[model samples]
Target: MQKVVIVEDFCIACYNCEVACVATHSRSEEPIKAYKRENLRGRSNALVEVNGPIAFSAMCRHCKHPWCLDTCISGAIQRLDNGIVYLDEERCVGCWGCVLGCPYGVAHPNLKGEEKHAFKCDLCIDRLEAGLKPACVEACPNKALIYDETMEETEGAYNR
Candidate 1:
């Protein structure tokens, strides 16, 4: 399965990945409109962490055994045969079970809408199907985020 691999050393903490993610997932599919008009500043599936001089981008690992899928009370989380973990917002009940169960802490609570729900990186399934790389990976100027297709499934929370 293809996964987004982080190269911490190459990260510049520019937040390009986050902006790209919001734009890609936004209704308008435009960066300026997504942030200014849609007010989707914090809705990016990709997150950037900065500590001192160290920084790196993070998203869902799409684990072989996803805790989010296992703990979803409403059955909103499902793992596809291609290994992509998906969250069906319409079926979500705001239980936050997946949020609590996600070891990577990537699962987020979507409180911006009238009905809240849990969300995380979907690995840009739509973009992937269209033969395009994830927004975050494509937007990284330094190539810190790589679309790695040769990654083998591993055991534990970091599995992909």
Candidate 2:
């Protein structure tokens, strides 16, 4: 399964990943346009976690057995064959079941006002379909984020 690995040593806390996530997910899919609208209130699916000098970006883990998938009363959350966890926002009722069920606390409620919905990382499904890296991983200047098949392989590559 494809997974994003955070290389904590390389993280600089610049928040570029967060910016890229919002831009790509925005209505216009443009950074400038997304940031320009006062009502836009773009939210990044990936969050930059900080603890003093230590920081790293985090998103959905696409768990082997997702609690969010099981807890969703509306069946809005589903797991793809390839292991991506997807949310059908049209079906979401803002019950926050998934939000509370998520162990990593990545799932959140969308408060942008255009629509009340739940949001989390779908591993940038559109970009994955186009054979491109997730926006957040591509935006990292220090290469702190890595997408790969396994943690061992990802770590081995970074170690060298």
Candidate 3:
């Protein structure tokens, strides 16, 4: 399965990945529209962590056996054949089960609209289907994030 690998040493704490993620998932697919007009400035799936001199970007790992999928009471979380853990917003009941179950704390609750739901990185399934890399990976100017298809899935591989 494909994964977004983090080159922690190369990260510069830039938030371009977060911006690209919000814009890509926005209705207008534009940074300005997504942030200003759509009020989605901080609703990015990709999160950038900065600790003094060290920094890195993180998102859903799409684990082989996702706890989010198992804990979803509404059956909104589904693991596709490609190993991507997807959350169907329409089916989500705002239960927050997936949020509490996610080991990485990447699953987020979407309370912006009238109906609440959950959201997370889908690895940009639409972009992948269109033969393109995820917005976060493509927008990293320092090449800190890598879309790696050859990554081996081992237990606690993300502990690094």
Candidate 4:
């Protein structure tokens, strides 16, 4: 399964994750160009918390038994065996059930307020297919976010 473990002991609240998320998800989809603007918030992503030693940064957990997939009567949300979850916008009914069902509150609707539909992290599946890390993981100067599929990479998450 695709996942990221963030090491809070080393995080500096630099917001590299937030910016990288926007760049990877933006309509332009270019990190260099995206950084030229003042609107880091322009993309469909968010930063979680900023304080506490060992404080965790969160995104889609892709639960073993997903409440989002269960509550979504429209069948918009589904999980793959590898444990990455995604919402099919075409099949979605603009129902907020998935958003409500998500324990982590990762699935968001109308991210920028202009968009009526919702979206969330799919573990940056596109980048993963290209043999690259998620943008947030690559952008972190502290290397707090480690994108890996092995059991060892997930040790930090379990400890938390």
| Consecutive 10-residue window with the lowest summed lDDT within model 1 | 151-160
Query: lDDT tens digits, residues 1-160, model 1?
Result: 5678888888899999999999999999999999999888789888899999999897898888899988999888998888889998889999999889999889999888666887799899999999999999999999889886776545433422
Q: TM-score for all predictions?
A: 0.92, 0.89, 0.92, 0.80
- lDDT against the true structure, per candidate, is 0.88, 0.84, 0.88, 0.72
lDDT of 4 by residue, 1-160 (tens): 4677666667777777877898887667776666565343644444556655544456777677888898888877888777888887778777788889888877877654544666777788889889898888888888677776874533234453
Model 2: how far residue 40 lies from native, Å: 4.0
Candidate 4 off by > 4 Å: 31-42, 52-55, 152-156
Q: What C-alpha lDDT, on a 0 to 100 scale, does residue 145 get in candidate 4? A: 77
Against the hidden true structure, what lDDT does model 3 obtain?
0.88
Q: Find the 10 residues in a row with the least total lDDT in model 3.
A: 151-160
Clash count for candidate 2 is: 0
124 Cα displacement, candidate 3 (Å): 0.3
RMSD of each: 2.7, 2.8, 2.0, 3.2
Q: Against the correct fold, how does model 1 do in TM-score?
A: 0.92
